[model samples]
Target: MATFFGEVLSVFSRAVEDDEEELEESEEDEDILRELEEKRQVRVHWGPALELIPNTDHRLHCPHLLLTVGHNASRFVSVFFLSRGDWDAVGHVSLWNERTLQSEGSACVLYRHRDSHMLMCQVDCFVAEDQLFQWTEQVLSSLEPSQVTVLSDCPAAEYQSAQPLGTAPRLRSIHTSACSEPTCCPPVELPNLVSGLPAAVMSFCQLQNISAVVYQCYSDVRSADSTAMDTFRPAVEQLAHSLNLDLCPDQDVLRKVISQAAVQSNLYI
Candidate 1:
């Protein structure tokens, strides 16, 4: 009986091994039909670094910015807000597309509290070769898509020729870290005033001055229900009023921006 049981266990083990082998073979076969990796290069100059920008650690509150850029599947670059208002230093992550920027990708930027008067900015979900198509959307979601500015390596001539634009986004004129820790401040929660709200909202709220805050919210999915907008309208209106920002609850515009964010962030069905 012992010998018979041993034989049965051996057979079962063999069967499991065979199944795993078959699955591996099937996956390998599928890869054979996939597109080959292409080698390309793209130059992304972040304009020029501003040397006179104010340090971030000393201020009570200041604005921050983040950017995501890439051209190919394996090549990508991202910027962290060392200081917003003027000069910036960015860390580049380029393990895949080391040369060109054509692949699809995404990036997001958020301000995390480091300490009492200091803030740390981070970029995440950056992929190079296999997962480049969604980098832009990911970064945008991180940066709050609705608040993003898609900048390209445009020539000075093209920029001058471009249509009218509002004032440029604020950057830190000079930034300094106080013992590598940001000063802590009160938590500020901005209301979700957009229509067709998404399942989850990711907020990047920055405290500027005691009363004003800069926040960007990314939702997991787009809302199809019309009433969803109503639920968030009052919350958003109250938030703006509380913060003293003179923004009216523009349902139509808010809906369009969120919808565009959903698409650009690749929050698709």
Candidate 2:
């Protein structure tokens, strides 16, 4: 996401906590339509991506955002609200020509060590080595893409570093004699996900292929029986218009379907 988009996420995340109050304020204006229109902005984007770290014991039931971002030739960003753990994010950047021999020969591998927030991603898909390094620099420059480390090592060698993003919350591990006892397992707390994007967020990711790639990853990793990942297209697209209009229950809808997720393919989009 761009600097403006990140600010928008902060705005919408804060708005989710203030929905009741915002709803109440909207009611006082009498013109419900106009109140909604004031919610539109192009600076923010809200969407979903798979957990880089998967759950081993229980199925998570959070509402993963389900909108698609279309394809484009320019750079754009998608910020995911991680469901495996609250607020831990995994971001994607649409940054390749996607139409070259080198890119065609390229591949990537992703690894997530047990019981850690650390994710090590090694990329192999790129038409040019300079462009690959450039994109890595751009991605690392932002805080939203936190905990990322780029390496120029060959395909055989892997680097290890304890590089943690400054703003991300630390994942606390449980260590005690009770670890081997099944009866003492702690309860799992699922995050209550907010599905629809406020107009601002929709425009931010829709700028390029941001939303499309986001929906692509989540759809690919989503469990077969998980219908909660489904979303209505008209509702998602109207987000920009939703800032001014009411959503109809009968809007024609479409589901985001992606056959590839990085979790399965281990490749950056």
Candidate 3:
């Protein structure tokens, strides 16, 4: 190329210009990823009920917190506790990830008893591994619960036993050092480890010196059903007296819950 002054100049090739554009695009993509990560962080939203607490500090003083993770456990809580209509929807936690399918309203909901200091959290959505710790922390930070109980479900195949499996769903438990109540189920065996949100909550409780117990039900059936839900009945009954929860909900409500779950699981629907 020649300039107007008659001086010769070398122009860069199209390939060099294209490489520069690609570099700029790569930088833009990195920015987008960073922004998306920030957006995906786990967040807890408190409802008006919690905000209207009489306490000066406005902190939720939960005497007991019952957390249910996964479809089966959530269904159990739905049928046995929430169906009573004595609890108020006090808050919810929201997070964005590839595995999460439920909307924010239904994913992770917090319900507080109308008259008692007990709170129940039902998590029906999938929480990714990286977000587990953040989810646990954000959910627990608002509440000062004396004791925490976690109910979760997993595939029965994941459980390893030397003998043949039984008819009923197997229950495995893990608890923090501060826990005082005796676990209704046996301790989870080695090599069959607890993971995901339940494990994260347990770890957080342990580190915080909060009394916590996790009851993990291993169901043979792949889908949620009354049978799997029943496995937690004993544990629920044990805690019901102390928590002032209903030991047995109406059979009609139980049927309704199971039917709704069945309809959702149907492929033809």
Candidate 4:
């Protein structure tokens, strides 16, 4: 009985989305978009917390937040504005490059944006390594939506390698490489590379200016004997698994993420 209704609703939802897409692409709607990418929250950071810019809309409705998935893709990144407890099927955007996240690590950041009428939240994470990425795919697929939202993979220039936290020391890890560009530099230390989950999230939030965030980290502490790094695929997957097993909080877990975000805001940087 429940399954029957669920299936029916899903079919209807798909039809509506198809209609909306058509309408948006219609000649009349194209003119509307040219006027103002108004509801478009893609590039705009909700705030320092969720990387969402402050509200630019003037609608009076419900309180909700947006989730932006980051990836290597080049097209407009998919962004979703969701209400609290919106575990229903989500969306994914096109990913231009999948190989990017397979190498380094990225921390997820949550942000809170306020306006005269409403408050919103936004979430960010790497596509390849984060468990939420899987959850999103599954949920969106279940909804029978036309496509999933995927953010562009963070390019090499923007990529930051997260190192093993507890196992190795930070200072000793960074070293200079010779015979290169004039700038000639050593490995840059990434705050996201730290071992402690709290520290990583804190660093990510601080870096992105997203006031609130929920992130759990897994660092690869390389061994001194061999000096070669392990493949990032398995390392990142293992860490993501560990984070899910530990019940790490995310925007999906509002009470906890909100509480933690508050604490992070109050922390004495």
**lDDT score at residue 84, model 2, on the 0-100 scale:** 22
Q: Name the top TM-score candidate.
A: 3
Cα lDDT for residue 125, candidate 4: 30
Candidate 4 residue runs with Cα over 4 Å from true position: 1-86, 98-210, 214-216, 221-269
Please state every model's RMSD to the true fold in angstroms: 17.4, 26.1, 3.2, 21.6
Per-residue CA lDDT of model 2 for 1-269, tens digit only, reads: 24754653333467676898788787877676565434221111112444322223322222122222221100001111111222233343333343432322122222222233233332333424334334333322221221111111111011112543132111111112212322221221122111222122223333422321112111212221112222222223322142232323211111121232324444554
How well does candidate 3 match the true structure in TM-score terms? 0.90
Clashing pairs in 2: 36-243, 37-243, 37-244, 44-201, 45-201, 68-211, 68-212, 69-211, 69-212
Worst lDDT run of 10 residues, candidate 4, spans 71-80
Model 3: per-residue Cα lDDT over 1-269, one tens digit each: 99999999988799999999999999999999999899789988878756644323555778889999878888888878888888888888888888778887778888988777699999988888889888887778767889899999988887887864576788889999999888887899887899888999999999999999999999877666888888888777766877576667568878887788789789999
Q: Would you estimate the TM-scores of all the predictions? A: 0.22, 0.20, 0.90, 0.20
- Of 3 and 4, which scores higher on lDDT? 3
Q: Using lDDT as the measure, what is the rank order of every candidate, best first?
A: 3, 4, 1, 2
Candidate 1 lDDT score relative to the true structure = 0.27
lDDT of 4 by residue, 1-269 (tens): 24745653323578888898898789677788665443221222122222212233332232222222222111011111223232322122222123333311122333222331222212333333333333333222222111111111222223355633344222112111221222112333554232222233334334433332221112232111111111112212332342232222233433443344456556584
